[model samples]
Target: MSTVFDFAANLLGGGEKPLADFSGQVLLIVNTASKCGFTPQYEGLEALYRQYGARGFSVLGFPCNQFGAQEPGDSAAIAQFCSLTYDVTFPMFAKVDVNGADAHPLFKFLKGEAKGILGTEPIKWNFTKFLVDRKGEVAGRFAPTTTPKDLEKEIEKLL
Candidate 1:
């Protein structure tokens, strides 16, 4: 019975933000990295957000350094990079571990809800995305190779 709303994580700005704040909206939750090759996907994510934000859809970004130390920056750095580089305006959270023993509870729950290729659960790389429906149920999982723009159809279906 635990939806994403049952979890809370620190905002990139410095406070705990309940996932409940995003309840009733279809969500595309992504584990991001700054220096990774897939970093440019931020533009596509922002595009999706801008295009569908008014329709009860949102893209929540979480910076993660767990992969190749690609995101080795502090909250301020991450926030600035996102704003200045990609003009991202979506809600972003503090850095979090998306895999291993210390993975964030919300991510652990998401992984369980949407297993990856061949039923694998671990996130393979940065830019991993999980799409959630309005009811907070995880609808799909996308690998780093799956660009954000490529998910528009599925996102539309969820909306």
Candidate 2:
């Protein structure tokens, strides 16, 4: 059975990071855009990470430019923006294509695991979120309109 751990992504820093590093932890994975209206989600996401990090929960952010060209900056700039603006301390990954032919393998697997509204698999917009349980199985998919605060109960259940 293929899991998200089967794929590896580039860290915002300079190394390849395999999703396997997060094994056994509940994960809230999101495709982010710095310049989009939803960019403020970084604050809520960071709050979730800080609140639950010690309890085997993690929030992973992946910058994606596929929507509205909102994330046109390079990895370093993206990293800096998140840190300076939102004080985001969670793991941020390199820019990736969340849709289309170049979509990262991990995202493809994630979408397959949990389809979005009306069973549509394609991500509708940036800030699309996926919740993964400790066993590395996808638990649920949240739409761009779903705020991070709305996920608290579900996250608590997973923890």
Candidate 3:
């Protein structure tokens, strides 16, 4: 697939949903985990989604266990944790590998569009973020350490 809209992913506790469902809206796609040190970033991500959702922006979270085995939970458990712990209300997808032979196609396209440091395509850790513009273009990539709040300006720019 070319643009992210060309791809699809299984939503947590739901059927597969096309990325096109978010077409025309700016997107923040994140590889999330439940038990990592960065797991608390889920709060900031939810904040951003609540603050900008009405402005045609959304956050898409994909739980991943590839890093440190931090997200070792099934769909139901993940959904419950995100909801009860962080009050996360954003769209969340099933667990996926962000870097590997089995990496999701959307992530493969995202990495190719916005490589990390030294133009590396591999995701370094959990919470790695890919910002997508309204046109479904991968606009920017943020490291796992980059908090969701730090992305406000860029998200505003896209909005």
How does each model score on TM-score? 0.98, 0.98, 0.98
Residues 1-159, model 1: lDDT tens digits: 989888999999999999999999999999999999999999999999999999999999999999999999999999999999999999999999999999999999999999999999999999999999998999999999999989999999988
Over the full model, what C-alpha lDDT does candidate 1 score relative to the true structure? Answer: 0.96
Q: How accurate is candidate 2 locally (lDDT)?
A: 0.93
**86-159, model 3: which lDDT tens digit per residue?**
99999999999888899999999999999999988999999999999999999999999999999999999999
RMSD of 2: 0.7
Find the 10 residues in a row with the least total lDDT in model 2.
Answer: 2-11
lDDT (C-alpha) at residue 44 in model 2: 94
Question: Which of the predicted structures, 1 or 2, would earn the higher lDDT when compared with the native?
Answer: 1
Per-model C-alpha RMSD: 0.6, 0.7, 0.8
Candidate 2 lDDT by residue in tens digits, 1-159: 987767789998879998899999999999999999999888999999999999999999999999999999998899889989999999999999988889999999999999988998899999999999999989999998889989999999999
List ranges where model 3 is wrong by over 4 Å. Answer: none
Relative to the true structure, candidate 2 reaches a TM of 0.98
Off by over 4 Å in 2: none
State the lDDT at 125 in candidate 1: 95
